[model samples]
Target: MGGGIQWQQNPALCNIMQEPWEEPDIPDVEAPTPRRALTCLSDEDSQKIYDSVPRTEDVFNLHRGDLELHEKLGAGNFGSVMKGVFRRGGQLIPVAVKTLKQDELPNAESELMKEARLMANLQHRNIVRMIGVCRSDMIMLVLELAPLGPLNKYLKRACGRELTMNKVIEIMFQVAEGMAYLESKNFVHRDLAARNVLLVNEQFAKISDFGMSKALGLGNEYYKAESAGKWPLKWYAPECIYYFKFDSKSDVWSYGVTLWEATSYGAKPYRGLKGCQILELIENNRRLERPDQCPPGVFDIMLRCWRHDKNDRPSFRDIVELLRKFRSKS
Candidate 1:
């Protein structure tokens, strides 16, 4: 449902640093465990499954013959996404198939498989659903088709009809809600952006593309770029850009840029500025101005998300609450 990915890199581990919210006064609440796939296996086998691609019993092991590949949807560094239909139980189900490029490094293939495993655990209404996996010479992930495709493209096309403020709020609100769910599970969507958000039936927004997402842990908050991976510079928080550090708070910073995209009706963030130039502007404390049609309340939330100090950024839970308030007012 989304596309235009660049260079990829495996996450690098870093030194442990306590999060601001994980204070001494407040006990650290245990992160939520992802719903495990139904599988009957020994502990040793389960450990092996956890280490590699775990078989999801609930999800189908889609055979190649069952899938009818149609038009190409989009392409990324790892591979391409295609529109396809899965024949199951005498029913045809529309699906999106994300294939791993055969030419990519073996590590890339493994990473994509791991991403599928992660997606299998994540089952939320606002998040794209992974229906199954096809593991042959070529690996493919079967996902629910987002009829309207990417949010950015959808917004651009919305010129035919007014992209109302309430709609924008609702779209961003869905993203925030999905992100809040991820945060609760200690998953950091390192690549959160408007382009990564997809729309189902042009009404329901769903977060997609978890290839760049990471499960946060001690000494894992900051991902040191192993190679020269292409990051979303404009959407990155200062800490993420300058130090390669990322967490839920950094995700909030990206969410702010996404809000800007929504408000500007899919216009590029830091338009006309190079990545380095955008970094310089951000370093100088320059932030995106509120869109002409943006509400003051919404703009205020964006400002809070873009706080220079990551600790100063509002939690996704807080952001969700603020969005609900705005929606209620509307």
Candidate 2:
């Protein structure tokens, strides 16, 4: 089982002008409410837990004991991720605890709150499971433990000839399938970088974080007004940079960047280049090139997605079909 995480490091809010997806306007989707099953760790009293530290005058940390907090799995700006176990009904369940310092981000609470809502509603095989959240003001997203980490990291260790084309396609196919599912639901995972994608086992890839996932067509009134904030520049689509908007198409664009990263063995989608540089390049209609190892088919798909015009990008559905065909060749 996974355990406690050491401290690490941080969301952009939905642009008010952006709209959410149009649902059938049902009264509600009644699933069993999480509150009834939730175990709240008050801001106080949780400090007794070994890995737990004082967060505030009242709040203590929430984590599986350090002894159970497995080896240092990974580290990031927010904190270190550790494997842990939780005993429930006489069984020990594995969990990944993403521990972050209370001050990791200026608005960690709001970002975490937004992520909680997004992940709570998402249910897809390609997406990682959010087991629960622990907080004392400091936050820890209790997520399903992906035994294999991210494919991007795996690619780095693949020694340039690590993965077979078939295996690579299999992983990308999983990502496309997940994207297809999200598009069908009318949600866009604005951030679909390699770091955000994880693999549970060798062949199983899962999109874990929903910190960037949001609706479409709901609040365009505010977010649409031209002054929206910027996104992570490296992974953003050209249109997203210009229009300050996001949609499934924009998601396709982000995925294209992800495909590029995967193909390049987790290389920076565009290294040494800053946002302004990318904007200038896009304004001039310049785009990224494929790596030597990239499959021609995959490279073409990425190109289509990186098109300057939003409408020119392939749909996630289209990409899925193409990926499946590519996969079949193997």
Best candidate per TM-score, number? Answer: 1
User: How many Å off is the CA of 265 in candidate 1?
Assistant: 0.5
Clashes of each: 0, 28
Candidate 2, residues 136-220, lDDT tens digits: the string is 5357766666655767766666635647767777888989999898887778777788877886555667886676566666654
Candidate 2's displacement at residue 45, Å, is 37
Tens digits of per-residue lDDT for model 1 on 75-122?
Answer: 765699998887766656668899988776668777887788788888
Q: After superposition, how far is residue 78 of candidate 2 from its true place, in Å?
A: 4.9
Estimate every model's Cα lDDT from 0 to 1: 0.73, 0.63
- Cα lDDT over the full model 1: 0.73
